[model samples]
Target: MKNITFADAQNLKNPIFIDIRSPREYAEDHIEGAINLPLFSDQEREIIGKIYKYEGVSQAKLAGLNFLSPKLPRLVKEILAYKEKGDIVVYCWRGGLRSLVFTEILRLVDIYVYRLEGGYKSYRQEVVRFFETAKTLFPVVLYGMTGVGKTLILKKLAEKGLPVLNLEQLASHRGSVFGHLGLLPQPSQKRFESMLYDVLKELKGFPFLVEGESRKIGKLFLPKELFQRMQEAPVILLELPEEQRIKNLLRDYQVDKIDIKYFLESLQSITVYLGRAKVESLSEDLKKGRFYEFTKTLLREYYDPLYKKSTAYLRNIKKVISGNDIDELVAGISEYWGEFTGRDLK
Candidate 1:
């Protein structure tokens, strides 16, 4: 069993990280791309903790061993299966007893594996440090009114092998009042930062593209340094006709397929802004399948006005790309970015 620093383990080709923490711990936050194979279940961990606190370390160790004895054979077999695919590196909360003992057991079976030196805690510290000191990033921010295809453009750019920091995807929210309507629950703040760090690391030293967003996205907040960098970076404004914008939004939101009751519930959030009477009218339109009218009313009365106010503070507008065709709009953005950065996209 060899002990490896997080940096060294990360450099290992085709490394499979096995997290030896409890399932609940892993669920809260763990290294990205890690597989969880716990040494104890959540309840067992609690039992061990109580023993350690009341009965002392010696008794706690005895209890832990008893619990682990029955699971040893199954655990070794599961790890071996992963070893066949790639190098297996194991870690616990702080590269402590659990990982140390597990690797020692594997050694007895002639299964050599690497142990993460400082565990998930170490990796998390690295993530926090990154956002604290990341200052040289060049972000080409995409700014546009709602339904102007900013997210779609980012997806297309990524498909073409360009660097893109997709904050919305990381947060699992679309960055709006209704952003969470059809999306999965947002990641925890720590997990969001960790995932963001992974992407930024991959795109280091490149001019990555990102969308213009407020400090907060759904329940998560962007790191202050990252938001500052985006604010100071060059901006590209996208435009689409009002009718086309409404159509794009309707498709994006899947208004026709979403539960009307839930949609009406989401509408309640904006009652103060749209007024109670207007929200009621929108609800009626939605019930009657008047999605076009519903979307148009929201965009013109709510989204567009808010967007106008948001952009008022942005002083840097390097280019504007507008078109009815998505492909053409992408081409226009790519062409301008290539000229501005003097880097060929093709």
Candidate 2:
């Protein structure tokens, strides 16, 4: 058996990551893209742990071996598939007994297996390291007022072969007061870093674009190294007309087709900015099915001010007006980015 680091395994042409932790631990948060070939199920693992603590190592080993005896054939089959193809990297919580035992099992079948030296926990430290020193990566920060379509344009840029990281999407957030309303549950911090580490590993030689965001996207804090890189990178600002922004906001908010009650509750937090009269007016519009007017009014009264406050926190931004068109917005920013950074967004 060989030992590998997260970075080394990631750089492999086609490395298969085996997550050997219990299903519960795997479910809570794990290295992104890892497949759980659990060494034990949640209940079985719990029982084994209790035995180890209360009975002794001998009893725990007996229990563990019994659990493994039945699964070994199936597990060996899976390991052989990877062995036939290429290198297989296995990891458990701490690169301790579980992974070592699994690797030994694979080796007994004459399969080459590598265990991560310190498992997922150690990989997270590297992610934190990457985030803390992101300036070296030279990421071009995508800056915009809210609802300016920065994230969508980042998607478009990525589609056109630019290296891009959609941080908010990874975090399942839109990065605003109203942004979290429609988002799915965010990944745990370990999982988030793992996902980040996996994606960044794929971009070795190219410059990448990242959304200019605060350290925290909703609840998950940006990795320290990455957040610092964003702070130092030169910015590309995107703009759009108010009417177009309202239209974009309507589609993005999903209020027309989604549960209006959720949207209503989200708006309550904006009451301070919208004032009692305007909030009542908008609330009544929701009841009356006058959403377009409601959106237009809300943009003018609430979102625009919020945008000003959010952008005030960022610096060194170069503006690219998107006019009333999303395509124009994407094109203008792409062209300028290609020219200024020498990283083609074409």
Candidate 3:
């Protein structure tokens, strides 16, 4: 019966958020760091929902109780383990039956439990609003074609404690046609925003560095405000030779390890833009394992051409940094950043 509003949940010390939603729902999205403690399995949830829709709430409640009765003892045992760790915050899709029932069970054992006031939906609103209206953030966006190790360099920057957010990593896609190769399916938009919020919260102040990205990184759209900030921020182009870029691509993409079908499908996406003849040529190269050659063509005929159009009006290319040496590139980024913010990255 205890309730903690999403806003107040932020101030709780050592809070452990327990998501009692179905597995499918939890997979779609939940509060960050939440542990999935489903009161009903995915199939069990669907059956209950159908009963509620056709039979009515009274019958639905009866069916839900049937499912909970057998699981109650184990659920309490699992919850009791978290006692004394911190305030335990339990929630369901909409602060409904599952979480409340679970909380009531725990309360009987004299264990204090708090439920999220409006469940995951309310928490999602706060996540969206935080991104849409975050404080004025200064972003220094690093720009490069498909390669030039921008993501790798972003990792280096983060390693050195620079405020850096890896959008592609958050989306679980690399932000290219081939971005999804060998990676998990892109997260739901809600899930993407939640992870993005987690990353942004860590670096709330100062000039944070983000890789140059389009409005959509795979299936996830960068929050409107953050994307706009990137477009308007200073850009440091990491220029590299076509050959070197191709080499970098091969190393990072591991094209040989990827399915030829996936690679061809990736090329298929740009057939409209690259034209059928070039697309066929690229596919042929992929089949023959001439990854380096295919990469060069992609950069020149597909990636670079599109990149040019994307940056055509971005006159804010404040500095051009290029080299195979990561240290050199890191130095270039650090120097440009200090110049823009007038503060050294300590």
Top candidate on lDDT is 1
Among residues 3 or more apart in sequence or in different chains, the pairs in candidate 2 whose N, CA or C atoms overlap within 3 Å are 131-224, 131-225, 131-226, 132-224, 132-225, 133-225
Superposed model 2: Cα runs more than 4 Å off: 10-13, 275-277, 311-315, 343-346
**What is the lDDT of every predicted structure here?**
0.89, 0.79, 0.84
* N/CA/C clash count, model 3: 0
Per TM-score, the best of the predicted structures is: 1
Return the clash pairs for model 3, or none. none
Error of 1 at 288 (Å): 2.3
Worst lDDT run of 10 residues, candidate 1, spans: 337-346
For candidate 2, the 10 contiguous residues with the lowest summed lDDT are 337-346
- Ten-residue region with minimum lDDT total, candidate 3: 337-346
User: Model 1 off-target regions past 4 Å?
Assistant: 343-346
Order of candidate numbers by lDDT, starting with the best: 1, 3, 2
Could you tell me the lDDT of residue 250 within candidate 1? 86
Tens digits of per-residue lDDT, candidate 2, 1-346, equal: 9999987887888888888899889877777777889879999999999999999999999999999999999988877876777678899988998898888877787777889999978766777776666555767788766667777878888887778988988888888766776778887877777787778867863577888888988778877777777787777777777777777778887877877777678778778877878788888888788888888887777767766776543566655455676788777766776677654422
* Model 3 Cα lDDT, one tens digit per residue, 1-346: 5999987877888889999988999999989999898888999989999999999999999998999889888888888888667889999988877788788878887888899998998898788888777546677788887887888889998888778888887888888888989888888998998998887776756778888888988878988988887788877888777777788788888988888898898788888998899899888998998888888888888788888787542698878888766667887887766677785523
Pairs that clash in candidate 1: none
Task: Give the lDDT of residue 126 in candidate 2.
Answer: 77
Per-residue lDDT tens digits for candidate 1, residues 206-284, read: 8889999999999999999999988888888888888878888888889888898888988999999999999999999
